[model samples]
Target: MSTITVDLNSKVVPAAQKIWIVHPGRNRSHIDTFESAGVVFLEFPALALRPEIIADDSLLRQRIRYSTAVKANKGFVRDDGTPIHIADYPTAADTDVSVHLRTVKHLTTRMMAGDLVIVPGRGAGGAVLFGEVAGSFFPQKSIRAAGLPFADTPVREVNWLTKRSKLELPAHLVKFFEKPPAIAEVGRDRWSEGFFDFAYDAYSTDARSWVSLDAPQYDGSDILSLVPPAELLALAVSLYRAMEQRADLTGLDYDQIIARFYDHDALAEAQMRFQSPGRYNLKDKDAKLAKWINGFVALALAGALSACSNGDHIEFTNKQAPNDPANAELTAMINMAGQSAGGAVLTKAETQAQHAQSKLGMSAPATVR
Candidate 1:
């Protein structure tokens, strides 16, 4: 069989940055390495792969399968020494072997040096550590004698950038860490990923910017130009939920979807305000515009947020959204807006988000919904 070699001295341009998850071992078995060492480890040490085999992904998987056949598995140790060696395969067909292969292979070959890894439940208060892969891959035992923590397994040098408490992050981000794997990648969920980028400072928009409840009133014309009030209110719902819960939303559905719209709209306005301040020059700004705008927007979303899409048009008939926090919030917004506008901003429950999108020129936002 053909073999490959890993060149320690080689240099190549790393690909676009990717975020990964590297568990801190089963029962925190590998937490020591993560806590004290500047590296991350993926433990599937059955193959004891050589430099050449580690370099060739196909060969590596083949070897992993081959090792699974060895009745006495040494890599997975049991509590007692006598029980330490056990059958590695859970099934005769080895149907579940793909995950292990994928994990090891990713650590050895697929993961570039610059890729980032998320090690959860580490540091004080079990903070999530965001670290970059600073060095190239090293197969099990190659760096063992080098005294690196958990060097007996597949190893990668990491430069931990920052750590945040699980409570301090978004709900979606915390939910992501519940996955049980030595290694995995965050899925391509739009909102979760967007929040990840935001939480990790990847968006260039500081996460702190989104943490506030205060939104400056926009001139009715200028703010409405960025996003129609109704859509903007929906987006605000999502943002408020995140800000209220300090969590990345799982999915932007119903009221959640409303929040996503507000987020984009707000981002557009923020850019205009900070990046191009001239466009944001407020003229006779209605200080309570937010109150009135949100009230109208809430009125629209209340009837249509949960409507099922029907071809091109949607039925906005489900209006009595009692006991829903979003509904409650909408009610408050409507009340506030009415108080500000010197009259009720209430509208008939006649159209859904789709109708609003089409009528109001709402930017077809990319949502996690």
Candidate 2:
């Protein structure tokens, strides 16, 4: 049986004082009021803006005008009073641009850093959405409605915590839902602690929880320190070579080899890097490129191990294992080194040396070394 290790230090600790719960929509009468007055509330699904457009005042004004027209069902008009139909502005979608812009402006200008906005869960026992305002308000194209008309929206850069997992309120914190406020601040008291504890517990118990992986677990920190790419590549290559040469390791299962090598940390770290949105600049561009390179190294090593497998057993024969060629995904990851991202690759000599060192029970040298 494989033993699972939990890193207590890596668990996410929620801050209650920064938390605020928001009701997604107003009463039906209120929505009707806005609609009757030719005002679009644009509260459904929530509006997320692009960064580039937010910075440009002139561009933002134009987008707002178009967006407002779309929301109001009034055709857009050029500054020179020429009517621009919705078909003419294929970039604008059904988003309420005015509300999105105003909301983004309010969030960026009025909200403090580290503030968290919580969107209530739909239906009974459903999960709520938690969005942490990571940065100031900015205008950018919407990923949710990309390549469609009216795609531009105002968005505050947010680190959404509950994007993947749904969280239920703990039994103790259920009272807050009794009279859920349209927008209420969650204090750093017992209720807040209970809520986070419930969230953490829910996250831990989920089948898709990241905590089960052995890599440096995500603690919602902006800065993440990771192993260097070159060093990681060397380790992966060395592991591949070791698996290739070991006669005693034949017929062992993949899990057995993984346990023996005890390098899941590297594997997990790599998986996180490769999978993380920040690595692809989907979130923050400067989230640390080192992590991405480290991910590539992890992928290479994991691929090398995977390539040696024949069905349920690991084939350690030299004929079967030359490089990690069997894994197309791994090959693609290694090829990333040649791409614009510029990750490191291990030389044959260096790989051999590292393999020899591993055979002698020596740890791989640090990146700096």
What's the TM-score of every candidate structure?
Answer: 0.43, 0.32
Off by over 4 Å in 1: 1-15, 55-93, 122-125, 140-151, 194-369
* lDDT by residue (tens digit), candidate 2, 18-68: 655544444322222222232212232223334565565445545555565
> lDDT of each prediction vs. the true structure?
0.43, 0.35
Residue range 161-230, candidate 1, lDDT tens digits: 6665655555767677775667887754434443343233211111211211112333345544444434
After the best TM-score superposition of candidate 2, give how far the Cα of residue 364 lies from its true spot, in angstroms. 29
Model 1 reaches what TM-score against the true structure?
0.43
Winning model by TM-score: 1
The alpha-carbon lDDT assigned to residue 94 of candidate 1 equals 49
Where is model 2 poorest over a 10-residue stretch in terms of lDDT?
360-369
